[model samples]
Target: MFIFKLLVILTLGYWIMMLGDTLWARKLMRQLPASPKPGGSASTESFASAGLAQPRGTTAKELPLVSVIIAAKEEEASITETVKHLLNQTYPRFEIIAVNDRSQDGTGHKLEELRKWSQGKRQVEVPLTIIHVTTLPAGWLGKNHALYQGFLQARGQVILFTDADVLFQPHALADAVHYMKETEADHLTLTPKIVVNSFWLSAFVQYFFFALSLYIRPWRANIDSQHKHGMGVGAFNMITRQAYDRIGTHQAFAFRPDDDLQLGMRVKQAGLRQRLASGRTQLAVEWYKSLREAVQGLEKNIFSGFQYRVLPAAAGVIGQLLLFFFPFVAIFVLDGWVFWSYVLSIVLMLSVYSLLIQSLIGKIGKELLVFPATVCLLSYIVTRSVWLTLRQGGIHWRGTFYVLEQLKKMKR
Candidate 1:
């Protein structure tokens, strides 16, 4: 019982500080200007009407060219829509390069068709190039390899790496370019808006983001003093061609599962400027269709985030159990004074949890109500992620089975 009390005291103190952090993060997120539909908002509107928006003091001719690259393995469901959105981007001095990475589905055919249409019809003002990879070499991960190929062929001053499933509003690229120039960032990643199809699953993503905010503190990415902490997003990652080359490019993170995140970390380590922004209006993606899929998607992340080690992963699970569920577990098992202490702790926890839910309302949208009830479900997902990763000995993504030993060697 004394042990429980000491743990509770520590947890409460930690969470109280976390509660303050979450609130500050919420305000920072709220301050981010949401890009509304073309001509809907004052700060953000149609690219056609606004013309090419250059940096505050720069002229139109001085704007840099931005190249957008997308790598897809089997993204037939969303690739068509995503490509269309990319072609219609408001950023005038930009090109799009879409890579069909050894896809078995109709994705390869679809990209070729899009390329031919763009060439013949002159539907898009910029050049659209497509590449199809036939094989994966032993040293490289498929998506990273695809991106590197695109980078090699990219001719723009700025290179954008994004997922094939992410949908961009007409002004998304323009907004990113403006932000990058304004902040003078060498690398920038914007968090995509959650396209909520499953209420509970979307809630978990929102809750997870807010929970991670306590540690990641993404809003501070642009602060010069907080350069040690870096943040990234797969939906949108824009970096200067020079920075990409300086950081060792794709070869730096050849086989890592958390490649996007590692890229951000590398950039920070190189003493470069990096920033993170919200894409609530400009960018969005259907992350998962169902709760089960969400669970499966996180399998590699939990373990990879912990460096594929066991003790740290186990500590994370145990920490979650004690920090969030201990009071409930003790309420039924304890007696008298200890029981009342447990009850008080549960009330305090609920309050902080409630604050986290409110902070994420803008992120998940419409399905925000499902968050407060999904804490236990999220915990189970974490435990299961650790279990699946250790049980399988390594990750199996797409068709390749990355042996643990090979990965550890590559990581070295």
Candidate 2:
């Protein structure tokens, strides 16, 4: 009985701490300036005045060369579409370097087809280099190693590292470059609109982002600020040659599974300016196909992404539960004045969550009805994360086993 009371006290304490942190973070987000629009007047002027000449009225300029590097492994289904999207970019001076990372399927043949198509259509004026890495290097993650090899073969002034599943909008490259120049940012990362068709999948993505926004406002804060911490989806990130060199590129985070987050941290540590752009307008990525895939996908990085620090991650999960389920739980679990108190807390939490979701949905032109479902969806993800941490050793992704023991070893 004594132990049970102690456990309850600890849980309640954790809940309060999480709530306080969320409120503080939301307050900070409110105080920050709004995120800049893609290819806006200010962005264009900033880039143009920074020595990169802007294309004259839709006639795209002969801008500095850009190499779009895509690292793929067994991505036969989506590789063709990704390649086609890159080839169709409105930007004139750019090349596509698709690294086939030991794909056992038709990924290699598809790349050859893309090459043949580009040659026939005269779609590619710049060089296109496709390198196949036969073996994985030591102390390096597969994606990072593939990207590093791509970098070695690239001759572009800007190197854009993207995943094989991403479909780019025609103007994405041009707009991204303009924004990079305007912001004087060394690294530019964006959160792509994760496409989800299944009921559970949609809920997972929605709640994930909603909970994230409450704690970390990636879009509003500068990358180098200590108070700023956000996930940089590596699916769509652009880095200048100079900035890449300054931060030592992928080699700096070779062993880290969550290379994007590690790279961002390194950039911050090096005191370089980075910006998070809105990819909701220009980029889309399908994260997973099914619920099991989604669960495994998130598991691989959830623990490691937190640097194997369980306390904060645990607290984060609990906070999310309180924020999302507190209202529903309160109406049934409490009585009299206590019930009303819980009701007010729920109202406050829901109101804040709803406002954030509505604003984001309006900005992206997505359906507003998906907002309420975010709570239910997030609750599942949080629960799954906890279960994965306790029951399973780790998460699986792309046939690789990332266990907690391995993560702890990597930390050393």
Candidate 3:
């Protein structure tokens, strides 16, 4: 009974912290407005006259050119459509730079095809440029190297590094650019909608997103008092050219699989102005085709997110089991106050998920039902990633096997 009481106290304390964090994040999220509609009044110049958040080092009369850089490897499945959507963006002055990163599939051919197709469009002031990388240079991850290559050829004052599979609504860039201009943000990351095809996928992705958001406290990055919090998502990471250079560029984390998050860390460490906006209304990406695919896709970076360490990963897994899974099981076995405590934890967890799902999907539906199952899958993903990396003594990414020793050395 005493042990159960102690467990109850510990679990209650954990839930209270989780609740506080969730509420605070939700409060911050509520402060940001939704992405402006394409033909809406929220043009790039809308906030200019208000001077609420002026573009740094520039007059409000002219819009700065933005270079959208996409790094592609085996992305033929979605590359064409991705570029098509980008071409339709309502943002006035921006260029698209696509780097074909030595793809074994039709990705390179498709990019060239898109380049030709974009030429006939009247809206495009700058034509789509394609760089075909035929070889992988030593000591570099494919995606990171490809993005850096794109950066080298970019001419925009603002640079946006995004994935090949992400789809953008026409006003997406306009909304993002306006937000950055208004806030004078040096680095801005827009949260994209994760398109989940199946019911289980929705649950897993939503729960995973919730857990990650809680851990990172992305909104806290905006607070001047809290100097350490920062984040970047792969779908949309936009930064000024100057800020990018200040953070040592991609070369600082050249070999990291989790380059997006590393970029955010560098920005925070440098004391650059960083912000997060809810772009779910404008940006969407089908992260993985299915649960099996999701597991395989996460294998490359899940362990790397922990800096490829054992204890942290193990602790993470154990922590998830206790905080996420234990409540469901304990609720059934315990009685009286202990059982109610577990119930309260579940309630707190669901409340957070409900708020998060509403933000991501525009409405909260029934994805919360599979919460326990999603928890299990998340735990499984972390364990599988760690085990495979350790047992194979390396990670095979983008058809290349990187030795563990080499990866560890690059962690610095």
Candidate 4:
């Protein structure tokens, strides 16, 4: 009985903290400028219109050249389309470099097809360059190594690292670059609209984002006073060549599965400026085909998010159980103020979730009904990741088995 009361108190306290975080996150989201509508004055929008201080000229010729680097392995399904979207970008001074990271599938052949097609079509404004990597060297992850290879071939002043599966609107890069220049950010990352068809999967993605918002506190990164706060997203991570080189480049965290996040961390640690923006309208990606795929896909980075430590991973699972699961169970089994306390905790949880939905999607829907189940699924994922890492002695990613000891030594 005593333990139950203690649990209720702890759960209530957790929700209270979450309330403050959700509200702050809401404020930050409100301050973020929306991406320009497609085919609606996107080509003519300037820094002055955004009310941000312009560092220099805003003409097409004056803008820094942007080199987009996409590291792909077994990405044949979307590489062609992704490159096609890049070719349509309104940003005049830019190039697309697609690195075929020793892909065993049709990725290389598809890229070659795209290259020939672009040449035949005379799309020289944004030349498409393809680098086929026959092998991955020692002490490097596949994607990171692939990105480094693309970087070596990049000639633009600004570089954008994106995944092969991401889709971009015609004005995505133009708007993003304009925002970065206006804000004078050394590194910029944009959040994509995750397209998940399954109701449960969508719920899980929402819960994941909510948890990330609380854990990383990305809103703090925008505040000039908060130097240590930073954020990154794989869908779109844009950085200047100077800032990229200053942070020691991708080689700094070669073995890390969460390379995108480590890059943001490096930028912050180096005292370079970083900012995150909502790109829901400008960028999108089908995160995973199904829930089963999501579980398998997250295995690589879920444990890494805990720094590959057993204690922290276990604590994360236990914390989720207490905060998300226990309250509902206690509400029905207990009586008196303790019951009411659990009920209030549930209400707070729902309130925090509502704010997150409103901020990210601009509406509240039925996702809240699945939140509890998704929380349980997420906890299982964390447990499975830790267990597999320990039992198999390593993690399997991109057809390579990375030893646990080596990974821990190289953790960021």
TM per prediction: 0.88, 0.79, 0.91, 0.93
lDDT of 4 by residue, 109-212 (tens): 99999998888886455788999999879999999999999999999999999999999987788778878877899998888888888887877888888777
Which stretch of 10 consecutive residues in model 1 shows the poorest summed lDDT? 31-40
Candidate 2, residues 1-412, lDDT tens digits: the string is 4543343344445445555655554443321122333243553554343333464343234466789999999999999999888877766678889999878888888888877877777536656678888887666667888889999999899889999999987767767777777678777777676777787666556556667665645544453565335345687778789878887888877767777766666666667777765576678888888767876667556666456776777776666556455546656855665566555565555455555554443232243345446565555555566567657775554555556666566652
Query: How many pairs of residues collide in each model?
Result: 1, 0, 1, 0
Which run of 10 residues does model 4 get worst, by summed lDDT? 48-57
| Winner on lDDT (1 vs 4) | 4
lDDT of 2 at 320: 59
lDDT of 3 by residue, 1-412 (tens): 8987887788788878877877777666733354433322344344443222333444333778899999999999999999999988756678999999989999999998887767776656566889998888888999999999999999999999999999998777777777887788998887887788898887778888877776677777676455576788889999999999999999999899989988987888888988876787788899899988888988766998788999998898888888888889998898998999889988877877787667645666687777888888988999999999999999999888888888999997
C-alpha displacement of 200 in model 3, angstroms? Answer: 0.6
Task: State residue 279's C-alpha deviation in candidate 4, in Å.
Answer: 0.4
- C-alpha local distance difference test of each model: 0.75, 0.67, 0.82, 0.84
Which candidate tops lDDT?
4
In terms of TM-score, which candidate is stronger, 2 or 3?
Answer: 3
Clash pairs of candidate 1?
39-46
Tens digit per residue, CA lDDT, model 1, 1-412: 6887787677767666776776666565532353332433444333435354432444445668898999999988888899988888766678899988999999998988888878876556779889888999888888899998999889999999999999998878777777787778899888777776766776677767655665457666666565566777788889999998998998989998777887887788788999876676788888888878877877655677767777876777677767766767788887776677667766666555566555434522554445435556667766777777668777787667777766777663
